[model samples]
Structure formats: structure tokens, C-alpha cells
Target: MLSVKKLEAFYGDFQALFGIDFEIGESETVSIIGSNGAGKSTFLKTVCGQLKAAPSAIIFAGEPIGGKPANEIVAKGIAMVPEGRRLFRSLTVEENLLMGGFAKRSGPWNLKRVYQLFPALEEKRNNLSTALSGGQQQMVAIGRALMANPKILICDEVSLGLAPIVVKGIYDALPKITSDGLAVIIVEQDIDTAMRVSDRVYCFMHGRVSLKGRSADLTKNQISDAYFGI
Candidate 1:
């Protein structure tokens, strides 16, 4: 239930996204795959309101929210699990998760529910956030975002530094997280993970969509062509 149109993002004089057009339907999982500097993260940042854009660029649930502040966006049912698992090291795991609920939106997601989604977090609820492993930390990040009970969840580089098995564990939990008609936009460098978990895939190249289609229908050759801009 989100639409991005003619989305052009810039970093001072250097532009990153080139009129990127994308959409995320209700309860849909959309993956964005691209190499470094392809603007995949840029797109997520723009959608999450970290990178400002024109008011008409991003529409969520039919209203334009492009230039809104990040807090406002989160309040409007969009939450982001940014790259690097930027958790509050000083806070306990539970405290970090509680921060997400500051939005105070009413929904199915809550501390109890998030704990059910990642049972491991329950045991570590009182532990220092920095003490958790990378995967556990990632879980905390995801759980933190879920605490907002968002309609759309944006995950940027969720698998960046975790082990393969750990990444798989994280991806495996996505179905349950999105089961309640939540739209998800995942920015992943791992093509296989992206293709596996997403209903549709969008390959970015040089700050634009080189290919977009059903994940199951997109052959390896087509993905390679789009991925490398061949």
C-alpha cells in the first residue's frame, strides 16, 4: 500500500536515485537487490523519510509522505530496520524494543508478540544490547521495528554481517512477521535470500530499476543482466 513515483534522491550535488518508480502492495514482500552504489539503500532511506524528497514522490496508503520527518513517517505506520542494526548499546534488549512502541500505535504487534516471533529475545530481554550476537542483534532490530506495529516494514541490509545460517534464521521468520497484511520492503545484497523471501524482485543498477518481475518467473540470466546492468 505504498507508491514511489519519479523518486529522485540526491546527496548535495550528487544524485543517487534516478526517478525510481516502485510500489508495495498490501501484505506484499518486495525485495530490492543491487550491488554497492546502486541506490538500493537510497531508495529505502527515501521511503523511510531519512532522505527528503518532494511531497509528491512517496505515497503511503494514498497520502503523500515524502518530506515528512522520520518520526512522523513511523507514526504513520511505516518503520525501518536500518543497516548496521543501530540498536542502543546502552539499553537492555527489552528496552531497545520498547523504544519502537513510542509511536503508540495499536495493533497485533506488542512486546509479548515480538517475543513470540523471536523467542530467543525473551531470554535476553534484560541483557545489554551490545552483549547479543549479530543475529540476535538483528532480531532485536526487527523486533524493535515491529513494536511500531507498522503497515509497511523497511529492512535495509538485514543480512549484512551475519553468518549464512543466522541469515537464514532471520529470513525464515519473515513470513510470520508479514502474515498480518504487513507490506515489507527488504534491501538485501544476497540475491538468493531476496529471491527466496520476496514475492517480487526489483534489480537496481546505476540508481535505477534495471529489472522488476515476479521472483519465481525471473530466470538467473535475466537477473544477472539486470544486476550487472548487462
Candidate 2:
């Protein structure tokens, strides 16, 4: 459903992604794993149109969409659960989630569906988003992104600040998401979680995909090598 070909990205002249190429199939969950500077985050930024790319680089549902603005990307059915859970601190929980659906896709995702996804969010819907705990805030973030009913959901470091139990709780919702035929591309630093949750995995090193395969087939040594560029 989404394809990125020879994606080269940069911050001003400081290039970060060097000819990165990858694809995510419809309803599939793919993880991008790498060391700190391997460009995993940059890859997602490029795909989401936060970073400009050549016209032919990012193709979403068949059209060349690289370099388009983030708002335009959402209109085309892509939503990002960004790293650090970049929520609007000033907005209430429900308001944050409502912003997610602003793309207005005609689909099964809505405020009701999101509240159902994270039951804790229901009662606190009217509270200021910053009032929630880290995990609860994470759920709000995910729910907010889901409100878009996006065809593809890109999660960048979904487990940055929570406990293991909280992480498990969020991951437990993945099956339901895939069941809805929404493609998920997760950029994760946690190798164990990434391996456990993904259908396929790509390991980036020095800005290129050094390894890509079904998660079940990659070995510890292979992942270690690809992760650290060993």
C-alpha cells in the first residue's frame, strides 16, 4: 500500500537518509530497527511529508506524494503516532482525539472506537491531555492518530516512556488494527518488542537497509550485526 524508493533525505545540507528503499503491504505490520543514527526516524519523516523528497520518491496508494505537506498526506489516508507523543498539551483528551479524525475518512474509526480501544480514555475524555499519566497519554496519542481512519498508521517509538506492562497493553491492540486492513509501519528502538510484533522487519545501518526479511527468520547475530553495523 506504501512504497518508498531510493529515498534520500536531509536537514538542510546534512543528509540523514541515503537511498533508503522499503515497502509496507496492505494490513501488514513492518518494523524499522536500527541504532540511534541509522535514520529510522528520518525514514518515517520522509514518508509522512515532514521532510521533502524528490517527486518520484514516496508513492502512497500509487501516487507520488513525497514533498507534499503533512496535512495533504493525512488527506490521502496516512496518520503518524509520532515519537514523544507530541500531543497538544493545551487540548483536552477528547479534543486531541477529535483532531485526529479531522482528515474525515469514511471508515470504522471514530471517537467511540478509540474510547473502546483504550477504555481508560473514556472517563478522562474531558480532562486536559497533559493531566494523564505517560501510558494514558500514549493511548490518547494513538487514539488521536487513529481518529483519522488512516489506511496506513505509522508509529514512531510507541514505547518511549512507559513501563513494560503499559507497552504490552498498547501492543495488544495491534491485531484489531490489522484486522481492519490498515497497514502499520512501526519505527521502534526496542528490538525484542519489534521482533515479537512485526510480520516483517528491516534493519537500517548508516542510512541504508542492511537487512530485510520476515521477523521470524532473522537471527540474533544477524540483527545484532545489522543494528550496530558490526
Best by lDDT: 1
The regions of model 2 sitting more than 4 angstroms off are: none
Candidate 2 lDDT for residue 178: 81
lDDT of 1 by residue, 1-230 (tens): 89999999999999999999999898899999988999988888888888989999999999999989999999999999989999999999999999999999999999999999999999999999999999999999999999999999999999998999999999999889888999899999889889999999999999999999999999999999999878
lDDT of 2 by residue, 1-230 (tens): 88889999999989998898899988899999998888999898888889999978989889999999999999889999999999999999999999988878888999888888889999999999999999999999899889898999999999997899999999999998888899999988899999999999999998899999999999999999888778
Measured with C-alpha atoms, the lDDT of residue 70 in candidate 1 is 92
> Per-model C-alpha lDDT, please?
0.94, 0.92
Evaluated against the true structure, the overall lDDT of model 1 is: 0.94
My TM-score estimates for the predictions, one after another, are 0.98, 0.98
Report per-prediction Cα RMSD to one decimal: 0.7, 0.8
TM-score for candidate 2: 0.98
